[model samples]
Target: MANATRSGNYPPLKNTEHDHAIGPLRTVELHPERRRNTRRFGICGRIAAYLMSIALAAALLPTPIGSETAHANGACRTDDHGIRLTADATGESPHFTSIQFLSASTGRAAGNGFMLGTSDAGCRWQPIYRGKLTFAQMDFVTNSLGYVLAGTSPEGPAMLLRTANGGSSYSPVPNGGNRFARIDFRTATEGFGFTFNDSGAHYTANGGAKWSKLPTPPNTRGLRFFTLEDGWAVTLAPGGYLVKRTTDGGRTWTTRLKASSAVGVGGAVYGAGGRDVWVLLYGGSGMSQTSYSLFHTKDGGASWKQVVSNATAGGGPAPGPAVKAGKLPGPAGRPADMATPDSRAAYLLAGSGAMDKLSLGRTMNGGKTWRNGAAAPGFEGKLTFPAAKSGWLAVTSLTSPAVYATRDGGATWSKTFAIPAD
Candidate 1:
């Protein structure tokens, strides 16, 4: 059933009518004339928002932002040392997809026309809220408190916003009709969210006001919780399904491991601390090729292993043919599908139709072996680092959508903005 939209919300036209029809609804109606020409370029837009806030003030100024003065307001790029900024929460252009940071100056960014903030990090990006939804996901545990998760429109009601001050202002965390796809918080009260159908899982210890539903195990699609007890949940059954665990926060949950019936776990599930976790499976279902696995566990969820396996496994990369030049393959064609770690080193973005690849794997000698770095440009959606050497790697371009950055971790990259081909 799980598919309603007559006011029950959950209708972003069934996921934006196949590829965001009409460019994210005309970029959310030209975002108030692009915020009145960025406040009439007041003081040169405040010196380009203070040189893009020196790349989130680089963990407290140790001297960064040098790579020919970092620049790319369209097709993103920033890595001469790394520091690229672009937030167009609806200013006619600059459509930041998803970004989150609790430090490095404080951060928050959502796309399609509203939800921006920057305590001095990205130089200056102001806008606290705007309705009509399109926020994909965001989570912060301190700095003030956070949560975003949006995609509403059966009429309304499918949000989850919350901010205790760090974001300036944000409220609305009722969500009884349940439609969240991803959300994870470890402190600031306690958190965990999931609902793609298989209908189960949702909890709040006070930060979200009130919520409770935990049980999830029936056809569970995907979920990853880092704290609030530990966290983990996966179920689809093709080979590996069901891996629930809760130290004690969720009250009770225990099932350790069960992933290896033969291999066929979908996609999306990430973690960094709380024992370092990661999951990305694809074999069929528009993911083309056939094989692409990367499962790792440090102990939190008891156990799990299968470091890395790529080549689409037999059902992942198939649409190849129109590469008159080179590089192009993301948008589910295969290659832009994993990002979920705050440290322990983790960053993988691959797409091959138009060519966009970047990988920087590190397990601190834990996940066994995974070492590869250098490659960027060709994104699918969602990849915000914030710190760990700088972040922001959004890319979804059929014609215009870009963002990139890497300090010295992924090697060398540049280009930091682009979303105007209209």
Candidate 2:
């Protein structure tokens, strides 16, 4: 993709000298007409030039995945037991990026400033809390306790909100300077939060009451804590990202393997035990295109084998003769490239492009084979599996995005009508 320009309109860096300056100072001064010409042609022209460069980049880069290749065949088919979904309460907009079910009867959904809850198997919904914060990720150790992490902008601080009485109320936690991207709880009393900061992992042993920082290896971007003692951290490197395992809690970690890397690692990391772990990789090779891959570690990242590659499954019709595979592109700019595979079962949501079109895939006996699920109407933002047989999908359509649920895997789906179109 084209490189975003480093222009004055962008937010200033926090530690830079310009951040300390009291009053506005001219970096460059020009006459009125000259300034007009510069504004019209300088930044705007540069942006347009960048777009052209990206188009060229896409043309030069190898096709990450054969666009024409059909979905892999021979994978186990999910039973057709249609799921029955009761229209639970909806939020300000039907666009929900995160959903968690503390149990079969209690759950919460979040997007934008709204958080909604259900108590009767999604039969009815109620507004729990509405604030200015836009939650990007959340996790629940139990129905009564959970945490939500919000993305930070210049207008406000990145927030860590906690609720002790289920979804009845929420209060902000004192996280100091860290901005968390992912949070996981091993138990109601022990939890961990991973941040984009280079410092390390921010952990809490006494629930969310107190937190301590741990030094993370360089280039670490994502983390998954299965239990207080058993967890994994994924770090980006030259070729792919590395997986580190911790058995004695987060006190120390051991390197497993530098799993296959692409532009960047997207989606959630799930571990069945100390022996099994899975991750999703996304983005293109510095080109403005898209590709998706999944990795599996049977012995805790000591070694990894690609369960799915750019190769089309089922040996189906070639997508116009495979374009020669070239070096994978660098990171393409986008969030929600991949969704966490289902913890109870190995399933993931992978999407590409501005449209965010999603494909659902599942691995039954580990990542040995993958079966394609039903096609989503639009971009699939998050996949929440309250039970192994029952799953919920949050997606964005052209007109009105909605949350859908499947009781029998992805065979059939039902929408929650209570969700608003905001």
Task: Give the best candidate by TM-score.
Answer: 2
Candidate 2 lDDT score relative to the true structure = 0.51
Question: How would you encode candidate 1's per-residue C-alpha lDDT over 231-330 as one tens digit per residue?
Answer: 5666666545555656665566676555443444445567674666766555453333334555556566454554444433345432211111112112
Give the residue spans of candidate 2 off by over 4 A: 1-94, 151-156, 197-199, 248-253, 259-268, 283-289, 311-344, 353-356, 418-422
lDDT string for model 2 (235-294, tens) is: 776755556778886677787654443355433466575777775544343232345445
Give per-candidate clash totals.
47, 12
RMSD of 2: 21.0
In order, candidate lDDTs are: 0.50, 0.51
- Ten-residue region with minimum lDDT total, candidate 1: 1-10
